[model samples]
Target: MPQLDISPWPMVILSMIAALFYFIQLKLLNFTFYNTPLSKPMKTQKHKTTWELKWTKIYLPLSMSQ
Candidate 1:
């Protein structure tokens, strides 16, 4: 049986940690760009349609009954 060489795993882990810190520093620390002035939303009036004004009973097919 041949043994696996794990020499490059340490460098790979270090690179991953460095990438995580880089991402956090660039994205998490730079959160002020998302801050903007808030504006009041426009009030919308609800209108009742013809179908909504009327109520109807719905029946399932007889074959669908348990």
Candidate 2:
């Protein structure tokens, strides 16, 4: 096989653009909602358990360990 070479400029430019967009969004949200509190307290949604949580807990690393 002939030697193959690849350039990473495209990936670098894409990631930089994505990061810039994220920062701009964060700045916009901060400016619009800096002092406003939610009118109502946020409620946590309850999920029905169907063995998924049990399996994940058994296999996944615990936060305390990390």
Candidate 3:
């Protein structure tokens, strides 16, 4: 078998740090250039009937029995 040649530890560490920094820089640039704010808060519909409360009251004991 042939012997393997590996890079030094400092080079590996520096490469990982550089990659991390580049990813963070890319994310920051994308957020700055493309982000937009919502014009208005979303409106939610109000429930006319309390259907969940009625179902839970009827089914809670039935489920617990099993």
Off by over 4 Å in 2: 1-6, 33-66
Each model's TM-score? 0.45, 0.39, 0.37
The window of 10 residues in a row where model 3 has the poorest summed lDDT is 54-63
Output the better candidate (2/3) by lDDT.
2
- Candidate 2 global TM-score: 0.39
lDDT (Cα, 0-100) at 17 in candidate 3:
100
Estimate, for each residue in 1-66, the C-alpha lDDT of model 2 and write its tens digit: 986655787899999999999999999988854677669987999887887555554455565553
Tens digits of per-residue lDDT, candidate 1, 1-66, equal 999999999999999999999999999786876768799898999999987999977889899976
Q: Which has the higher TM-score value, candidate number 1 or candidate number 3? A: 1
Candidate 1: list runs displaced more than 4 Å. Answer: 33-66
Candidates arranged by TM-score, highest first:
1, 2, 3
Q: List lDDT for all candidates, in order.
A: 0.91, 0.80, 0.79
Query: Where is the poorest 10-residue window by lDDT in model 1?
Result: 28-37
Q: Which is the better candidate, 2 or 3, if ranked by TM-score?
A: 2
